[model samples]
Target: MTLKFGDPDLEGLKFLQDDPLVITPIIGNCHVMRVLVDNGAFVDILFHNTFIRMGYNDSQLTPSDAPIYGFNHMECKVKGAIQLAIIIGEEPREATQMLNFQVVKAASTYNAIIGRTGIHTFKVVPSTYHMVLKFPTRNSVGEARGDHKMAHSFYVITLRPDRTGGQPAEDLVPIPFDPLDPEKVTYIGASLDKPLKDRIKTFLQENNDAFTWTVAKMPGIDPNLITHRLKVDPTRKAVKKKKRTYAPDRLEAIKKEVEKLLEARFIEEVQFPEWLANPVMVKKANGKWMMCIDFTDLNDACTKNCYPYQGLIP
Candidate 1:
């Protein structure tokens, strides 16, 4: 389909063509905001701050020795790399793709950068002048509009020398509970005094049970105390999605994970279910395959909770 930006695309955008096209796209399970669409970049990038905030551990990153240079031709340290599912545009017209992103330690106003690689992968036609992106879908062209105001705000932040470092307000340093197994560790405020840090580390080690190191260590909540039920509409017809095939290696990983869950009594086999969904394999930063269920049909049939709890109650 022919994709073109018109006057409607420039409705809310200012006449300033200098503003970068920044869009918010669903990356993995998070709706990552302030993602710069830099066509000049050679690869997609995920900033370290955003990666940590997304609940990922540094150990999850796949090792990469290769380095990448910035626009200024200066070499930037590569933290590692990760693959995540990215959805651009809204449903019915949206396109989904698993993209490899280089995670960088450098701080930036933006959480991620979708570069030329992503643009080509999505077959997107981007118009920086209109601050919009269009890509071909199954039926028609899908559109992802950029936030001009947010882009300008970030631009201003970049100009500020005090804020441009992109460093977090508070830095965290990792402290391993078991020196033998460095993988089992936790983070503490880097600014803390040496004595305070030692005390905190000791406290954590003493109460190590509080930290779940593996799935086997997880003591699941009792259903008697609290249980969740899907408010599925009865009128909605059940959907049985077709089974999806996976690579042999991914299939093996899925099998192993499923077995582990089954052994832990976390999941049980159900025969001849009315509504069925296929499992999706998402590659983790650690080069592991994570199985996820496609619950779109099930979610569509469920009613939204308008009065969700706002905060904790005594």
Candidate 2:
């Protein structure tokens, strides 16, 4: 008989209440990590960054045409998919099967998310009140317990907005100064007209928390909400070039800038990262050097977004 949510096996769970269902499951035979068992989601998502951390390569992804949407109904970019063997229960009760997951460039508190499709695949019934997932393997019922405290923590983490080091380096264009509040400023391409500038300045000053002037001002987005992940092609062999040396002055400036970003929690150190890319130093017109990652090789592997450009025609 197929397992059902209200099965008598779950009756003992009525005593518990008020917690989201969360559990840690092993993936690719790696250490067990937390995954939010969300029956509401139609698709299972394995974050690109988390996939890399779990020792998976980008080439493993099988291109998926179906796009996934977030709670806000915005279309999320799907990099690809990979099939992995998933095990739910322990010992004789264990049920293992190959599962396909669509990889995305999202960051979340959970390493992986198992959605309704995954739940159905395991033929399991999940209960938030019981904090457990129940399924029948053979004639016996198998149970996977949920981590209540962890699930609640992840719930709080996903609500935050996405943020990065003072905006992306590509958007480092000239900003307009606030006339009324001399200390304030607006991002690139602001209206040059004095009246409009003043109005923008006043509005910004009124909503100061919305504007971040320096690294100290940035309240980064929750990693779970949105995260930047480079989809490096794993099929391509890894490349590591010798570190390029820079002039003393330029090196000093890079060090200082890196320190500021680190202090602001915009970037964290990672060990033995895969998909190496060289940093290119560009000489700005102001004689200062700007650092940018040379992702030419990385870009070659990604699916391009072809938004047609209409030149100067109204």
Candidate 3:
């Protein structure tokens, strides 16, 4: 599905909204907590709390060092991106998907945003309206362990104009959305199972206010702005800076670090328990352990946040 701007034409857009884009808060390097995925943001991570918590007091971020933007549509300061581990999918059948997210600093509850900047690096095709992510698998179907097949695959919303003619006038901008308001959110995930997709579509249809946001953290803009631009980093220029040392420590510390790094050679990521989806059990299957989350009654009772979106609120 695709979305187009300017003039009325239903054939030009497939309005897949970014409902509840899979937002994950990952804890890495101890005391480092931030949201791993925030679909709205094109680039730049704002981590006001993270920097404070990490004991980097009185240090200001460099805005010109690297261009950063926010929901307010203002120039934002960007710190560097540190790697983090984010558990993908729901419990029982869940798997660990290591991702490299920008260490964003923000004064809001929206910690560490894994923007499209990081997502585009991987194989992702998003069906925004359905709230489903179509990502690719890493390992081949044969050598795959357990039910795991896909690598780190995340999808994005593409506003494609309708190939079929004869329809109503459509919005000439990217789908409008409110990240703060629970009601205005578009749900995104791995699948659009019948029940889930129906629930999502019902929500979108019922709430005409539901739309997508291209520039997260920006405030106040014409609702019709469709010429959205994502921050683009020249891969060639960035790679010119040769790799830096991990940490200068004792030989013993260095050896241990090296070994640990080697073990995680396949994926550059961090590890944690809370990231595990299902309730872990004691077992050994083909020299591997079973990890899963029991998302039974817990999800039903989960309460929404308190912040009501400023403009989105009727």
Candidate 4:
């Protein structure tokens, strides 16, 4: 009864939240994290600052047995087993895979979490009078781009240069922002006649498919179900904040040989899809292709919020 963002609720696509709840995780091959399908959330994850840029070390965190809520509910304080690997829903399936290692953090963003004590051992189902959320087809995983693919969620268009007196407006400007790195879509303006940077490099070499979209209307809440609250920013005491400026054996040797320029190495250390820092790979056979980046220097050092394509368009 509260899902508005482009409009299209024919009873929430004929009530289908039974499985395929929008979850993603793929560490070495890359896809990092795309969480949504919360199974009741008890204490599944919390890593934030990109898990310290992924080498995680709050003095080698170790303090959780289970229990650390604080999204305003207040309780905070946890540091338990975080070995890794919850791969989920697809890939050489072995019960959709599991090996939490020992993740323990209540509030999230560190790029790791799947709470409800592990979504109540996979039996989570929720519709909320058609808000949508259900996962229980033998603990569903893989092949679930459900809800017409979350109604196409990948917004971020920041291209500006509609100058008025400063001189710089040859027809190339558009703005839209969300950018949590959902498969990417950040243009931040200024390609001049470069034509929206050639239509954002042909929308990442045509993969997000025509990037074809028309659903306009998102201010807050319900872009296909949203639940938020996560913060962990007040550092400098985890051993004097790791003795000054990030180090955990230098990010574990930069995450054990950081040489994965993404071949679908979908970059995911807390969603690095800020476009791409090393994108430029090309290889394909039956299933493989490259060209995915639009981070644009962390969206030009962040801070320009978008939304300026209103009134008319062809």
Candidate 5:
């Protein structure tokens, strides 16, 4: 049935202004935040990141054979479809629909996209002018109100280039998460099917000890499975390079990284290191510093595998 609105429904139009209409919908069963209602989109979509946040594992996703292409002509692999229970709004009014969402890994302004398929299924009419969505429930016409304030915040959260064309000017604020603690391990976003969601919660609880919360608690890899051996040429004497200096900020970052490595037992302080490799500080795209080692001298001295392995094409 086509959507019809009264004067009372049109009253909400004032909130629209220039902001995109974004709503919080109950997907699967969790109240999924930042759902964009895009009438242009042909199919419903659940972002891969949002799918995980819904406490779903890859195993639960059904494989999709079709490749989805965007308006930009970029082809994206469909992760698979997930049947989710969608609740449009809260009681005493709500419209419920069971939908198959094609899971994708692309980044977007919203967590999930309620597209044309969903619009047709739920018989929803979205009003950008009204800044709200209207749909029919069994009892009455339900509304999923758009959050104008939250929509604006999503813009700020998106990664964007600054004038210098370096790192993104804004990065997502870090959320404190503990993988080992089951209580703290709850997926903070979205609604999901209770049975399936509870199953995932139980899975995390059961395997709590399997997660390594910090580097200090790491047990490390066993030598029998795999080990790295530096094949340095003994004939060529080890080159102990002169210590390199870094800027104050870079020096602090290097020192902190070195201390972490020592604490994690990944590296140990020795009175004298035969092959001294200087620390290299590099700026990351997120405006963070990465500490690396300059092993050019060491790598140059190592013997190359001149002969190719058997069965490898030349």
Candidate 6:
């Protein structure tokens, strides 16, 4: 079935550009609001405040040690994880799915974030420009429109220092590894003692080549040492995805990244091959665009290794 967005989808939304798609969905009998739909996120998140407000006790959460990193590269402590049934849309058109959410204690305007895993479970197609989420139903397509006003309000709150409390002044401090080039630096704990800090600086200065400041500085491993080969099923038909167009800003970012890779000799131009995929652009928390190739089709055709390498259990 064909699912498309048109002028009708933008009927109630305000003409605010760059607004995140925020929706209110029914979670475990409660109508939860300010849930951000982020395709970039791998796992669904539930804020500690919202988790408590939902009439859930701490005992209900299963202990987990998995680390969750934010766009700033700082780890967000996970209190635990819990599975909750979430109902999206309304009436007969709605779809229900039990989702696992990682509970975080970080202060934020969003109560929850529905990530790629949840989106895939519901087979959802989200459009930030239209501010709507469309999913497949039994008969027809079901839509859950976003709250533009709430999104705008949350975005405004994010810009305010009082709401977020900002970062601590002494959290981390840059320590220059090279005195001649002050720009070549690394971060260290600001609370470290003078002797320890001096030792660390000395150690880093001695091993300056180990730190890769840029992608161009990386000297990749030799293929003869360890090479990776895709075990694609010979019987499966090769799929070539259609080229997708991107916005001007995203297009420029992709072009710049591709040029850098070319200069670094990491990627070379190739003619039409059997397998083809499109590139995806994700906005980083630091206001930078990260380009990633979509390898879904390629992965589907590859055979899974039954005897995969296993790590030691702790």
Top candidate when judged by TM-score against the true structure: 6
Task: Give the TM-scores of the predictions, in the order they appear.
Answer: 0.51, 0.53, 0.31, 0.20, 0.50, 0.55
Q: Total clashes, candidate 4?
A: 20
Winner on TM-score (3 vs 6):
6
The per-residue C-alpha lDDT of model 3 at residue 251 equals: 36
Name model 1 segments beyond 4 Å from true. 163-314
Best-fitting candidate, scored by lDDT: 6
Clash count, one per candidate: 0, 3, 59, 20, 8, 0
lDDT of each: 0.82, 0.69, 0.39, 0.41, 0.74, 0.83
Best-to-worst ranking by lDDT: 6, 1, 5, 2, 4, 3
- lDDT by residue for model 1 (217-258), tens: 688899999997888989889999888888899889889999
Root mean square deviation (Cα) for candidate 5: 21.1
Q: Write the per-residue lDDT of candidate 5 for residues 1-314, one digit (tens) a residue.
A: 44665567556343333456789988887888889898878889999999998899899989886567775577876889989999997797798889989999876657999889999998888986567788877667788878867765453345332323433333322222365544444342234566765666667767767777568889889999999899887877888978777789999998889888889999888897889888877788678888777766776566443221222321
Q: After superposition, how far is residue 21 of candidate 5 from its true place, in Å?
A: 1.5
Could you tell me how far off, in angstroms, the CA of residue 184 lies in candidate 3 after the best superposition? Answer: 40
RMSD of each: 16.7, 16.6, 27.6, 24.1, 21.1, 13.8
- Among all windows of 10 consecutive residues in model 1, the one with the lowest summed lDDT is 305-314
RMSD of 3: 27.6
| Sliding window of 10 residues with minimal summed lDDT for model 5 | 305-314
Task: Please write out the lDDT profile of model 4 over residues 1-314, one tens digit for every residue.
Answer: 12122234233564332222344555323455545445455555645454556656777656556655543465554555554544444533222334343444332322554666655654444332244343434433222222334322211321322222133334334433324544445343464456757776566655644343432321336646976432322331111111123245544433433434232243336542212353333333433343333344453333332222322211
Model 4 gets an lDDT of: 0.41
Please say which candidate is ahead in TM-score: 2 or 3. Answer: 2
lDDT of 6 at 189: 84
**Better candidate number, 1 or 4, judged by TM-score:** 1
Q: Which residue ranges in model 2 land beyond 4 Å of their true spot?
A: 2-17, 155-166, 169-182, 188-314
